[model samples]
Target: MPKMGFKKLFFFKPSPPPLSVSNNTFSDSLMEENIETARSVITECESQSPPLFTNTRQQAKQYLHAVITLQSTMQYLVERDSSSQKLVKAQFLMQIAMKRLQTEFYRILAENRDCLDPESVSGISSTDHQSSVSDYDDDFPEDDFQFAGDSFSTVAMADLKAIAECMVSAGYSKECVKIYILTRKSIVDEALYHLGVERFSFSQLQKMEWEVLETKIKYWLNAVRVATGTLFPGERALCDFIFGSPEKKIAESCFAEICREGAMSLFGFPENVAKCKKTSEKMFRTLDLYEAISDNWQHIESIFSFESTTSIRSQAVASQVRLGEAVRTMLMDFESAIQKESSKIPVPGGGIHPLTRYVMNYIAFLADYSNALADIVADWPKNPLPESYFQSPDRDGNNRSPEVVERFAWLILVLLCKLDAKAELYKDVALSYLFLANNMQYVVVKVRNSNLGFLLGDDWLTKHEAKVKEYVSKYERFGWSKVLALLPENPPAEMAMEQAKAIFQSFNAAVEETCRAQSSWVVSDPKLRDEIKVWIASKLVQRYWEYYEKYRGGLESVIRFSPDKLGNYLYEIVLFRAEESGSVSSHSASPPHRFKRS
Candidate 1:
């Protein structure tokens, strides 16, 4: 059942006087009558078949009234005549009332455990507590006890509060507080245990394997959410409501003592996990721990606000700090790993490098945690990148990316610099340029397609895309410069027939030699590959065709290629050609084929 609020039960200090008496100064007859009435009510409540506050709530109020009256009567007697038999008898009646009240208090807390559980009580809201003294007056019609409310939890909480007030007023707080702490503490402990939160020494964590530790970390991530989001808040609400108002200090003290050790154990686990060996592979788990604490920090501060429970809050903060340190260390180690790449073997066909794939994928995953990383590396020192490194204009103060963006961009820069060094392993200058283009394009695509695209922004992508074009331009210039340099500057300029035949023979040999050599060099991106092929064809085919038409009148014996043959050779540059589909007699040869841009 949903809970009802209990704010009305928390009464202020200097408790009101008994309903039967206006003041402490009572006449002898009035005092005797009050004492007799209190005795009779206590006697009947103790002997009643049903327990107090369950079926007979009206009688429960009568018992509470008698207890308060007996307490007042005893005080009045002590002030009037400390040695009189009346004072001693009133003290005896007060003892009986206190004993009866203690029994009911413990009984109500024990039997109403489910209704008074932290989860149920915390569900009670301020709006649900709008019922006033007049509202309860309408229900019971008893002016002496107006603590009753509309729901199961409301009635139970109201009864407990009344009993607690009477017991504390009668100097029986030790008994009342002891029962409360013991019962509630057990519930908190059991809930935590079922949630899989356990106390582990640093030695246990240190000795655990990564796989074992990772499982525990995953469980801790989920357990911390439940413990902070629901468990601790619920407990705090229950403690505050029951022992509230005049005895709020008692409530704080009780809660701190009960939950202090468990909370300390819970928040301290991440710190111990941080102390484990830092590896590039372990960084994500460490980051997960940091994010969990960061997400729940506000609740941690508010629920553990007591001075006595400050250590719980401190422990949570310490875990976040330690996890941050671990992440920073792992990131630095990852950068060093990138810089330390020493493999001499060039990628076959000038395709993407393995180092490039690994680092780009790693950085892309890191960008998924950009917000956490921004906080982690906020204070960590890093070298500033040069202004020329970025190609776009977003680097100004007004449009700068966050520290995480700068950090990620820097990591990609390191990978690119390492790739530049690796490119030197290729003896062919054109092939080295091809290798750089392939890897740089892979890195740019990885960033553009992932969360890195948002963190690094389009400006970063624009800068890198320009870099890919630079590498492609260099590859085309150096890889095909020899073939283009052999053609005449002016194809139609008058020249001797012998010189023209010599030029045609030399040009044909150079084109075949260049195409045969470049046939094996690879561009991994299909779009970029087709683009490079078409660009080479446009330059070479146009110039070669111009020279061929001008000199083809009587040089058929020397000319080995028509424009169509050259176009077919260009089509077969990067990959094998498809087989002819049918007999050649069905083909029309009217117009020569030419490579065109897509």
Candidate 2:
């Protein structure tokens, strides 16, 4: 009953006309009319004559009004629940509006170019003129933001074409290039941000959104080229943005594309390689993250593993071709420089002719290649080989193949060589090569005997023991001298003792393991077992005597070789007991006194 008052009745009255009702139609019709008004303004601006207004203020006001009206219409469209068709229509209308505004402004500016010099423009006192110019400069085409759904295609295409024409007409190619690059950057940033928000996986992105992003990037790069006669500055930044951004999902998808097609090759850009190298160097500086660079390199290696039939094979071939070209260039320069040096000085061995030097250099190059191949094999992911995957071809290509097992052994040898080189003031490279003799033996055994059972049999074990003993003897002869020479001239006695102790411990472990394994054959064959026992005894005796000589009766005697001596002593004690009990011949015992009383 109280609601029957005038205040309550006011709510029942008809509402005032909406600002959109100027056309006196339904909401939809009113919207259509507003859109038409916007379209007309655009058409008028597009068709307007150059210098339509002699006054700078008038020209400024015209540019300002056009920009504001276009912006307002864009907002209206964005708020409306338009269908795909309507959205497309709205986008097209906005595109036309933008084109008209830009064309008229440029035309007017060109005509009044002499009058609107920077200094003269700066001297203008009207705040409205300054404000209008500011707004004009501030206005970015709504074509970037206004398009909805299917409308994006039509608007985007039209805007691109118009931008291309504008750049061509303005003769501001450099400025256009910069704008294009910045625009591309912005688009990429936006895409990456959205991708992060969506939390898409790499595979998901590749199947779903990769093409869309790629299309946008391609358009941007093309626009840059069309706008500018030269490539964008810091061209590598684009590569980094794609490959090294924190939006991992997008970057990973981009990586897949890059892997499928050599990204640099696809883009026809070497700047990407420079970018990779730079990023790799930065990663390398942080020891903890060095593996990141290695991971990327490994990824590169995986891409190179293409069969002859796959599409990626072509990209691999291209990468190799580029590498080969670079190597050829380097070799040419090296040979030329060496020839110059040889020409100036009478070299040893008949001046070591250029061809001979080249041959030697090529040999060295092969050695380096072998070393690098070994490293790559070592670092490859460890998984059981797929049934159909082909093995890597060896340098000789004689049915011999690269295998990680042998590569691991070679890596150990390389590490030993590096340690030796630094440990000794001057390393004998021959000794380093000898250190790898064990690895070479393993490789030979692997090649000749593919059966794992045969490789681990008695004959293989015997050969392994012999090879190890040979290396041990060689190490013993020169190791102490090398260690002493490498140490500071007056190193502390404790330091020397520590070094000697470590060496003895390592050698003792190797000898003891070999001896113990060899002893296991005792129950199988008497004659073969006796031979093995003797060999084991001889090694143990040699190592024991070496330890005693170094340590005398000290901490080294007590702690350094205790385990080795105990093992040898136990063996001797068993042999004596067997002889005394008539369980074995005295001939098995060299001499009881040979064992020092522990």
Best by lDDT: 1
lDDT of 1 by residue, 1-598 (tens): 1112111222122322243323444476677777789878876765766777775566766677777777777787788767756655666667667666666776787777776666665554322333221122224534322222236666777677667777877788877787777777878887788777888998999898888888788778778888887777777766666666456787788889778887988999999999888887787778788888888888899889889898899899998999998898899999998888777777665767777767887788787678789788888665577767753234455433467777887888898899899899888898899889888888888898999887777777888889999998999899888878888557658879999899888888887777767676667677777777788887888888888888889999989889878876787543322212231123231221111211
Q: What's every prediction's RMSD, in angstroms?
A: 10.5, 24.7
Runs off by more than 4 Å, candidate 1: 1-29, 82-100, 123-150, 382-384, 391-402, 454-459, 486-489, 492-522, 547-573, 576-598
Give model 2's TM-score versus the native structure: 0.24
Worst 10 residues of 2 by lDDT: 589-598
Which segments of model 2 are wrong by more than 4 Å? 1-33, 36-40, 49-95, 98-360, 363-598
lDDT of 2 by residue, 192-230 (tens): 333222233334433534335333333433432321111
Give the per-residue Cα lDDT of candidate 2 at 259.
28
- Give Cα distance to truth, residue 489, candidate 1, Å: 5.6
Model 2 residue 320 CA deviation (Å) reads 4.9
On the 0 to 100 scale, the lDDT of residue 153 in model 1 is 62
Q: Can you list the residue pairs that collide in candidate 2?
A: none
